[model samples]
Target: MDGTHLFELVIAMFLAIIALHYLAHRLGLPPSVALLTGGAALAFVPGLPAIEVDPELVLVIFLPPLLFDGAWSIAVDRLKRHMFGIASLAVGAVFFTTVVVAVVTHVLMPSLPWAGCAALGAIVSPPDAVSARAILERVNLPRRLQILLEGESLLNDASGLVLFRFAVAAATTGAFSATNAAGTFILLAAGGAIVGCVVGYAWVKLVRKLHDDYLMIAATTLMCWIAYLLGEQLHVSGVIATVTAGLIASWYQHTVMSAATRMRGTSFWTVLVFLMEAMVFILIGLSLRDIVERGGGFGALLETMALPALAILVTIVVARFVWIFASDVAIELAHRTGLARSVPMGTGAATVLSWAGVRGVVTLALALSLPDAFPGRDFILVIAFAVIMGTVLLQGTTLGAVISWAGLRGTEAEGAPMTMSQAEAAMAQVQFAKVKSLAFDTDGNLIHPQLLRRYEHRATAIIDYAQRTEDYVPMLHAHFDVVLEAVAVGRTELIRLRRAGQIDDETLRELERDLDLEELSAISAKA
Candidate 1:
């Protein structure tokens, strides 16, 4: 492709993704699925040159932000509740997959050595962060199930990559030692944890010193890359480093960072991840072009498809089912014995989680990073791509059905339930505490003494609402009489305009959404 043509293709890709993403949101499907399908559709264009970006660059640059954002959003206490199942799936399942795939690959492909098989296995073992989480969240699976799946995917990607690196090193060097591998794993993991915490905490302290929202937000974006690069230079797992840093940053985020800083930082990171995800899918489509072009015929396809990829796919799926079921039983037993903190899992939730495991960009990036001169490199890449597309596109599309069939869709009570009054009071108190942190005088006294009195008044009003939850309806009627009347009048106008065709369906929807938010806030304020 020429420079102009390539630029045109890039523009077209974004336009297609944005338009299709809007459509998907309207249809209540995860927008990621639509973006993947939309990108792939562009591949059907005659003689359209494919867009090719370095997979290593994609992994190192794009992955940290996504993983970090995921960890940041995850509530520490809630994640801890599902840690048992998550550990089993993330660590235990990866080990199980490596052994299972190694055995099958060696037996089926006698020419391929154990190291080569192990490398392939490790690359395909972990589920992808982008596609899997998007589909799982859309199903609205019980909150426990959602957290367990998301947490498992987030950490397992790190663990699996760590394992993959060891296998690749062993393969390239023609040496394999379980003892050395185990020792290295421990040191690397420990080192990453230490570095991540130090870096994250240091960043927090620095942000507190500056207290500039824009600079604080910029520091977060920079932290993801810094953690990854530092971990890589130190020969530790960057994924683990990034995840740990995100967790640490989030822990201090509520207390240290200003509200404006948090808002802007969250928005920036979300948009960055969204763009990266779209580009990754488009890259996947472009990758398929290379695979097909290089293979060139039915015989090449048949050769690559022979046995190993199929075995890996089957093992991954079956292993997930077994692991989830066994872990669920153990968790239930623990809860019964008064040893567990979270609710025991149900059969339906386990089944949904098992089927929801989907491979994504991390898997693809690992494949593309394989040394071209390595023995069986072609086969390894082929199998990795096969596993990625099979799980991400096929399974992702059907995840909602699995959730529905298993009767696992709904918000499960994972955290301690908060009453309306309790939630409001807690929030109001948090705001008051943050306001008190502002420094104005030489000795860090209050910035505005009058602001303290106003905060007190606002907090008292919030406390009053909580104390009269039962009388909220009447209280709401009394507090916002004028606003409610205006909202009612505007809603009536929107309905009339829609019926008369003066405004289109889209215009009516915008008006309704704004009205809903206004009403919800008013109602919640009364409580």
Candidate 2:
């Protein structure tokens, strides 16, 4: 496509995404599902051009930011607590599912080589990080379950893709070694993580010297791409590298960035992730045209390929359930015998986790990347597409219902209503004391009685509202907005004073930082 046409297509796709997002929000459907359906519908529109997505470009452009943002947002403490469970699912479950799917595919279609089946298995094994997170955010999963899912999605991409590379190589060369592949996986994961840490540390040091929020945002964006590209060039797992950088950056940002910088950087990443996710799903839908065309049309493809596709999809779903339950049982036995320290996994949590394995863009990209000469390439592609659609459309859509049906609602401890109330009460008392203390200046001179009275009244009202009302959140929000407005006005005056030579730039900056910190605190409180 020409540059002009490409630009036009980009604009059109974004517009469609916005429209579909609104529709999905109104219809109470997942945004990914809406985008996928919209893209498919657009494909069938007369005179609309079919846009082919480059799988390599998808990984290089979309994967890094998505992975980094997810890692950055994940709760570090929660992940640490559940590291064992997350590891078993992310690494072990992925390996097990890959093998199961490969066996089933080989049995169903004997003509396809074992290597090809393994490649297909690896392609669809890891749940899509973007899809899982997007759906999980909307549901009311228990805190531990949510963290486990998020952690698994964040790490499994690296494992699944590493396995994919080994399988592809084995298929092409007609040679394979379990020991060699295992060694390669370790080297790639460890090397990628080390590289990410070095890069993240360098970025932290560099950003500390910079004061511009926009510059900080741009620098982090550059860091993600550079980290991924560097890892790929070094023959390590780029997904791991990006995720590592993001986690390190997230931890270090609090120390290095000003409040304003951190807030702006967060907003930038949020918008970027939303756009990337929307584009990926829509593009997946758009590619349906090409897939259908290659198979000589939808009806012909289904007549020949439907049964195998359904079988593969069913196998993946069943494998996840088996692994989750089996692992849980073993963990329980170990705990009972005092051989391991582990919590008992409830049936509800196990069921929800099993049903949450929805495939997405990565699977489609890998399938499309298959060589033309590969055995059963078309058949493999068809099955991959079917599985992606089936899992995402059927399984993704019903996951929340399944969680509810299994009676896995958030527990009282997980909800933490009592803790939240206690915190709110403590915060109100602290603010009330601060307001009362503000009545006098540093010179020990009392502020004007009228102004002092107004501050005291507002503070007292907030405290009473917090103590008496179940719905005090709105009152708190109003109080926060009032403080924010006052801080914003002070910041503007500080800038004006510096511009008029009434204050030096250094003094102005010092005062501005104070205001920024106050504003950040208020915003955080409201959130």
Residue ranges of candidate 1 with Cα displaced over 4 Å:
1-9, 26-29, 297-308, 332-343, 412-417, 426-527
List pairs with backbone clashes in candidate 1. Answer: 143-412
| Candidate 2 deviant stretches above 4 angstroms | 411-527
lDDT of 1 by residue, 1-527 (tens): 77888788778877877897898888866676676666666765788776565777988877888888888888788788767777878888877777777777777788887888888788888888877657755667676777777788778887788778888888778888888877887788788888788789888888889857888888888898899888888888787888899999889889988766776787787787777777777677667767666566447776768466777788778877887787778878888899975565687778888888788888888888888877688888888877876777668888878878887656535457886567878898888777666635778766788777777777887788778766776756786776777788999999999999999999999989889778767766543
Which lDDT tens digits does candidate 2 get at residues 407-438?
87664334345555556666766765676688
RMSD of 1: 6.9
Task: Give candidate 1's whole-model lDDT.
Answer: 0.78
* Best of the candidates, lDDT: 2
Q: TM-scores for all candidates? A: 0.81, 0.85
Query: What C-alpha lDDT, on a 0 to 100 scale, does residue 419 get in candidate 2?
Result: 59
